[model samples]
Target: MDRTTPRPGLRAQLLRTKPVDQIVSEAGHGTGGPASMRRSLGLWQLTALSIGASLGTGIFVVLGESVPLAGPAVVVSFVLAGFTALLSALSYAEMAGAVPVAGSSYSYVYATVGEFAGWLCGWCLLLEYGVSVAAVAVGWGQYVADVVHAVSGLTLPAWTVQPPGSGGVVNLPAALVVVGAVLLLVRGAQESAAVNAAMVVVKLVVLALFCAVAFTAFRAGNLTPFAPLGAAGATAAASRLFFSYIGFDAASTAGEEARDPRRDLPRAIVLSLVVITAIYCLVALAAVGARRWTWFDGVEVALVDILREVTGQTWVGVVFSAGALVSIASVVLTVLYGQTRILFSMARDGLAPALFGRLDRRGVPVLNTVVVGGAVAVLAALVPLGALADATSIGSLAAFALVNVSVVVLRRTRPDLPRTFRVPLFPLTPLLGAAMCVLLALNLGTGTWIAFGAWTLVGVAVHLGYGRHRSRLAVPAPVPAREPR
Candidate 1:
């Protein structure tokens, strides 16, 4: 059987499957074809990848929006969201280690559940990462505006700061920040990771400064009645804050590049989750302790409210806003990185156009990075994503569920595979992880499911129209010849 040979029929083409060994081997080779995607990540860089992705948008942009829902108990919401993320992170860690591939869950599911499911997962991830990048870029635009106004008392033009629905032609700053990340990524993985690490440190230091500065004004009276809306409200807030946890699996996207995929990927995933969760909790506590929850409700930049409390100087506010800008920029970089690499893997496997998988001499997917950045920049400039955050969350949670189930299935089928990191409780961990992801997705409401359903329908159409027979894996591998008797 030859790889380029067409399958016999439509059904065969649509359902064509690749064995785990074949998929893993191709991924290990780094090219899967003529163009080779480079592997240049280590544990620290991988940690920066996840931290840079998930830590930006939530604390700076969404926390104020969530305060009305959970009151002072927003702190509890951060903890709960961390728990859900931990479950999914464990599953991703195990699979990334054992599979050691760039596609993340997309490659893992292809090996376990067949082609259609794999394509569906990859499609969902595309939605997740794309929206995440746009959403964070928009947030970055706002912070940048704040910093500029703080320094010079001159606001960025409204047309450049907001989308059309908000009475602006385009989010120019948002699109610009996305382009900045594009330039860094096009340089090379090592360059991108180095910048990401530096930004991660900046974000963390700013967050710590925020906590310390805010605690100086802490009165404790604000939390007297913490659960204003009750446990239900806290749970709802957790569902919303789960948006912040989207990028832990970003480390899994670097599985092929990780210096020790089996050891480093899992550690990076888990460590990033823990550090981000801790930061969220501390900041949430400090913010609530400093001001009543009602004060933060509908607030855009909640950290500024506390940063202004600096008795001696006003520079703290400027520093905090600048830190937020750096954080959001890093997030756009890391998530965009994940998006292109995953698509690269898909292209290599014949699911996407070969152009997307093409790598330049430096082993970077230059064209692919530019294309992804351009699409997301347009999305940030043209689309109002305020209402679509839930839609993005649903897509991410669905992909997480698929990954958790893939882990269990792969365990049964490929038990002999080398796994430096294994899910702790076997069936229990994955079962719970998959269930939690579905539970969170359901909490995203009916609108999200409708949007997801529509996107998935389009994906099915694309697969049938282009990816069906075009997939390189549709043809089976040839059998070895027996020795002459």
Candidate 2:
């Protein structure tokens, strides 16, 4: 800001934008101190991190929930959902290359839109990442119970394994898995990414095994009368299945830790989305083709059950459940990692409490990781996340819509900005990306809209009460004559 100019009023304070050059500079070191994140992540590790975050419960668990809605046409639902994700991913790749930062869309919006819009996007991200972590953890407990029963002939008491709303005293396993992920995160980013990469390999092999076995029993007749509920039903299922693609942007959150964020972030984001969508479609096809879609209703461990029914072998189901256990745990870890980093970025900008940006000796946001993990664990233990998938989808969709808007705004405002990646078709791609996100969000139920509204109101209050006043932009500084290109 120019010191000679008069202090701007409230509206200016609310609408001030962060410069992209400042964001890139901050990515290389901490904003408040000399301590910085360790830049150890490479392209493959970033791809694996994204796959680990995204390629979980959506296929292994939510498929059961969606199959009943779309019937055998759930395969088409996956394709529709994947297409929606792809449009936004192209826009994400472009913005990520131009303005690499840990806040993902939140930072992109702050740099391109303004402070108020950025805060709202960050708020939505909080809902998307934090709640999804708990929702995925809850799914993990179900597979844990299934694995234990299948391998040991021991049925864990429902009171201990299920959440309160689901008739259990507490979800013990859900909380424990979150804690396990926190432990791994505290060790450091590179170590955690290495473990996540290994888990990604295990899960891919597990899914392949499932496809090989399930296809052995595939019957073309099973896919007859696909979309029994009609195109409307397939669209509805696509809206829900969009949750399956939520973490494809997980790679963008690693901007601060990527060895070459400008290059790797865009490639990792698009590459991971492509891989995840293919696997999701392939898995959905196999599950529906192997068994009647009607049988999927109310089945939590649908894939494991499909294998059991197709082979009539308990060991096959046991193996699948064991793989899912590893699979879901990976989701918990990566999503939680993303949650902490989003907060870390916000804290640095003074939108969130400074504690969230604090680093440990290993350059890990240890306290932030623990705080986020603990909250998610508690939420998983108590809340029955029956509606959380829709809630998460709405939040993510809203953030993605703003990301597309950000890309357009940045192009107009800073045409000289360098970009390693550009969305093909120019405005057409980003326009469709924004339109698809809004369309998918509209497909969600009224309950999801109500919840999203309440969350947004809370965010507004927080911003007005705390963020606006404490914002770094609120303080006067030597104004840069020009922004970096």
Candidate 3:
């Protein structure tokens, strides 16, 4: 064997870059041999999935934290955040249609950039998906606590409710919810289009109930101090609340599974964003108007708590809490499924351990599911919910920025490629999208930036140490056939 030949020799192919042509050629087969992912989703199901994934936790859990940052101006925060997300979502739809694959942003990067850049994108997505799932699980635990208190008139021991660092030895409720979601994912895997639609309906109904009751108590006085902290405050809250809008892109991740991706994916992304932003703005207005925005400050289960306050009845709030139970679980399952499949694609490209890429007989990535589930459960039990939300937001912003950048690059580099959906503003959309992501990222605390840096550093080391050399792209060029021999 020629020791100097590329690939097959744990030699020094650490900085190797795969040909864009080869990467693009593998478009729909990003995950390699697809065991079983049913393409049963349509426009409605896709839209619902996007809405469900982004709706939960962002408002139900993080809104309270965000309100203190912007006061009544938090309503504006939703708009800013939604705008940034919409830009990214637009780019995602374009790429999803042009590429039409399972890897989401990572696959798009691989097809445009090279192996290392794709590795970085994949790493960032891990943060977005895994941390967001853990955060949702923690939020679910809070709703579970409220439901228990409302139903039985007894609060669970405080230690059993919060994450470890948040004055609790074990966040049992959080862990339990994570375990439940994990089991659901690994066992049956993706939710059917019907189930997803049902969950979205449940979410909309509960939100409508909150808006209706809260509006009954709406007082113009609550709007008196709107934007009291000014544009800076609204932007700050927008940065924090970015967590809420992360899921609209979940629709793009389902491109390969959509019935009519080119048409449906763009529509689903736009419709879901419009529907979700309207709900968020209404909920924000009603909540702030019903009770002073200050009242929402530091609330963990803001919406449900608002219900309890307005109705003067814990049981009434419990009904909304139950709805959160449905919404958050769906979010967890959707993001978790996205995470597993992404890593599966990375593994297929030799950027991760082979174990993660292997699918069981039923076409599910059982091992990947367990690994992701276990990590998320541990974080849900140990990390504080606020920190988890921040981590997820920062990671998501980075990935969103890269996705936008990829759109611009792919356009100039591969103009011949058919793009079923196109971003309306061309360079303007992608440039603004990337700029907004970086700007919002700066708003995150020093601690969050540090955490994101650490995660990226680890990913770089992993690629250098393991992935760079092991990547399947290391293969040598094929030999040409000789004279009829």
Winning model by lDDT? 2
lDDT of 2: 0.91
For every candidate structure, what is the RMSD over all alpha carbons to the true structure, in angstroms? 3.0, 3.6, 3.0
| Ten contiguous residues minimizing lDDT sum, candidate 3 | 1-10
Off by over 4 Å in 1: 1-16, 28-35, 310-313, 476-485
Model 3 CA deviation exceeding 4 Å by range: 1-36, 187-193, 480-485
lDDT per residue as tens, model 3, 107-214: 887777666778899999999999999898888888888899889989888788876667777788778877776677665434544665788889889889999899
The deviation in Å at residue 405 for candidate 3 is 0.6
Tens-place lDDT digits, model 2, residues 1-485:
33444567889988899999988888845435557798999999999999999999899889999998999999999999999999999999999899888889999999989999999999999999988998898899999999899888999999989887788989899999999999999999899999999999989999998999899999999999987999989999999999999999999999999999899999999999999999999989998899899988888888998889888999999888888889889999999999889889998898999999988766788889999999999988877766778888999999999999998999999999999999999899999999999988999999999999999999999999999888887766665566557
Task: Give candidate 3's error at residue 170 in angstroms.
Answer: 1.3
The Cα error of candidate 2 at residue 385, in Å, is 3.2
Clashes of each: 0, 0, 0
* lDDT value for model 1: 0.85
Worst 10 residues of 2 by lDDT: 1-10
lDDT of 1 by residue, 1-485 (tens): 22333346766555556786777677634343465556778889999899999998888988888888899999999998888899999999888888888899889888887788899999999999999899888888888888888899898888888899887889888999999999999999889999999999999999988988889988889997999999888887888888989998999998777777878998999999999999999999999998999998667888975788544466888888999999889999999999998998898888899888887876788888999999999998877656546766877888889899989888888889888888898899989988888776766667778888999999999998888667887645565655668
- Local distance difference test, per candidate? 0.85, 0.91, 0.82
